[model samples]
Target chain A: MSTATFYDQVRTAVTNRVPVALATVVRGTSLGAKVLILPDEVQGRIGDDALTGQITLDARSLLRDERSETRPYELNGEPIEIFIESFPPPPLLVIFGAVHVAQPLSRLGKQLGFRVVVTDARSPLATAERFPDADEIIVAWPDDALTQIDIAPTTFIAILTHDPKFDEPALSGALTTEARYIGAVGSRKTNEDRRERLRAAGVDEAHLERLHAPIGLNIGGETPEEMAISILAEMIAVRHGRPGGQLSNAEGSIRGQVTSPVG
Target chain B: MNEWLPEIDQWRARGDQVALATVVKVEGSAPRPVGARMAVSSSGELAGSVSGGCVETDVFTAAQEVLASNEPKLLRYGITDEMAWDVGLACGGTIEVFVEPLSEPPGEKDRAR
Candidate 1:
């Protein structure tokens, strides 16, 4: 396929938030050849038939885990190198309360390249004026708003409504999705009470274990902006599977794995 | 690459030959991850980056060669203990960049048709 056609496909997939992979030949006979891999079909070619087949399989595996890496192969005793780059959709951060904290959190989420969605039943609170940077504002109840969103493994859910009427339903609805981080802003006592209510409402223990109650790291944040920082820090920590500790106290390298949210 | 697409498309539309450099592989603690891209126009205009300002100068020079010859090349940069004290990669990591000229400029496409 032509390079223009390949790039057009890439731009379309990225604009539509579709997961795709691109494999480029960095070494061997067909230098600079590219193959575009979509969910249902693969396009283009990387010169050699055997090398293309092997690279396509590897690209599919990398796309499944949202990873990009280079691999070396031997085609008829000749060294060949290919780079498989996976382009997963931007992660989603759904805030289920348009409170003071949600405002700053939504901005921070947008800065971090997340598709921020701020939802609240109160129409006045969930306005575009409040969350100017949010990609979406859903003025609906927590259950209805959560049901409409396509929550994937890269999604992060934050239940910021302190009231039980709002928090319980949001938590229940969020637990049913595949969100990676489900943080609820509340005190220890409030989290315990919410957990009891969730259990009574038939939320299983496995799902309950996904909650990051008393959200945010122990950073002693007091103001709403500070709390937003701490909460975003915790969300990043959870996404990287870190303990949210100081780098000075860490044992290994400061940089985590190259591929984030490794499955 | 996604972020640089607009600039690349504009460069092609302006009748400038373009070269693209991508970080295909990295080791240890490189500044950028794999798949990072840098686009260089024939007029010396540059967009995006593949490293933390350490290896970009060399990559830019290589991009010029790719643009001239229309031959793609793979370049490797590694930080050794001796070179680390000098002006080489101080990040103590290695990165492999692939540089290639774009297929055709917009003017060329219309002329060929």
Candidate 2:
């Protein structure tokens, strides 16, 4: 395929939030040949048919984890190197409330490459002017708003609305999805009360366990911005499957563990 | 690479010969992850970066050669302890970057149209 066409496919997939992978032959014969792999289709070619088949399988596996790496493959007894680069859609940050904390949280989330969306029942409060950095501002009830969004494993839900009217429904809606991180803003007593109310509402203990109540790392944050920072920190920790504690106290390297190469 | 698409497209529109360098393999510590790209134009203009400024100059020079020869090359950079002290990687690591000329020069597309 032409380079223009290859770029067009990539641009469309990325803009439309589709998961895709681009495999490039980095070494051996036909270096620089590329194959673009989508969920349902494969575009372009990476030279040899046998090599392409093997790379496609590897690309699909790497796409699941949104990883990019180089792997060695034997094509007709000759070893070749292919770089499989997975391009997952940007992570989603759905803020349930458009409160003061939501403002900074949305901004911080955007800065960190998340597609931030702020939803609230109050139309005036969920205005675009209030959340300039947010990719979307929906003026709808929590459950209804969430129904319109595709919450997957890369989604982060933050229920910042302290009011039971909004927070309860928000938490309930968030629990139904496969969101990776779900945090609710409230005090310790408030969290306990919210948990009791959720239990009364038929939310099981297992689902309640997913909630990060009294949200954020205990950084003694008082202002809205500071609270926003704390909340984002906790969300990041949860996303990386890490305990929100001092890094200095950790024994291993600060960086994440690297994945071993696949033969 | 996706982040640098807009600029790369602009360069293509301008009909400038361009070369793309992508980090294919990284050993040990790496500033940027695999799939990171750096695009260089014939005019020496550049966008994005494969390294955190430690190896861009060398990559840019190599990119120029790829553009001139119309050939692709895989370049490797291994930062040593002394090099790390001058450059800013916390630890020494090796990175392999593949540089290739674009399939079509930017101006050629416009001419074809």
Candidate 3:
């Protein structure tokens, strides 16, 4: 394919938030050749039949991991390197409650490249002015707003309403989705009472285990902004399957693998 | 690259030759992650960055060469390379950049037509 056509496809996929991968031959034979891998079809070609097939398989695996890297292959005493890059859609951070803490959380989420959506039943509270950094401000009930949004594996839900009316529904609705992190903000005593209510309402123990109650790392945060940082830190830790501990205490490299969330 | 799409598109629309330099591979304590990109227009305009203000100048020069030659070039930068040290990639990391021309060379446009 021509370079213009190849880039056009990339622009379309990226603008629409579709997951796509591009494989380019950076070294050895047929340098500069590219293959664009989409969910349903493959475009362009890397090289000859055998080499192209191998690159396609590797690119597909990297796409699954949402990773980008270069791999070297030895062919007939020649060293070939292909760079496979995956462009996954930005992760979503849904805040269910336009509380004071949500303001900072939404801002931080946007800075981290998340599509922040702040939703609340109170129309006055969930305004664009309040959450200038939020990508969306939906003035609707938690369940209603969440049901409309596509909650994929890259989605994170933060329920900040300490009130049972909104928190219970928000937790229940968020648990049904494939959100990577589902954190509920409340006190330890409040969480126990909330858990009992959820259990009485038929939320199973297995599902209850998925919830991060009294959310965020124990950073001893007192103010709303500090609380936002604590919550976001925990969300990042859960996303990477880390225990939210200090790097000095943690083993292995500073850059760790992003394990798929069991939640 | 994704963030610089509009700027790159404007450069293309204005008929200026464009080259894309991407960090395809990185090791050790690299400043930027893989897939970080730097775009260079033939008019000397630059967009985005692949490193923490360390190697962009050299990458821009390399990108101009790619735009002129219309051939992809693989460049390596690390502490092992004296130029990298001079350029201030002091993070003790190795990065491999793939520079490719996004527009056809001026000579090729006539031949294709």
Report lDDT per candidate: 0.84, 0.83, 0.83
Q: Write down the C-alpha DockQ for each prediction.
A: 0.42, 0.41, 0.34
For candidate 1, write residues A109-180 as lDDT tens digits.
887778899999999999999999999999999989977888998899889999999889899888878889
Name the best candidate (by TM-score). Answer: 2
Q: State the lDDT of candidate 2 residue by residue for B35-64, as single tens digits.
A: 789999988899989888888988999999
For each model, chain A TM-score? 0.89, 0.90, 0.88
Q: Candidate 3 lDDT, tens digit per residue, A121-206? A: 99989999999999888888878887778899999899998789988998987887788989999899999999999999999888
Residue A39 lDDT in candidate 3: 83
Error of 1 at A171 (Å): 0.6
For residues A151-257, could you state the per-residue lDDT of candidate 2 as single tens digits? 98889999999899998988987887799989998889999999999999999999999999888998998999899899998887776667878977775544443
lDDT of 2: 0.83
Residues B1-113 of candidate 3 have per-residue lDDT tens digits of 13434578888777787898898888777777788888999899999888888889989999988988888899888876556437746777888889998865456566545
> Among these predicted structures, which one has the highest DockQ?
1
What is the lDDT for A159 in model 3?
95
Model 1, B2-84: lDDT tens digits are 34446898887787878889888877778877778999998999888888888898899999999889899999888777666
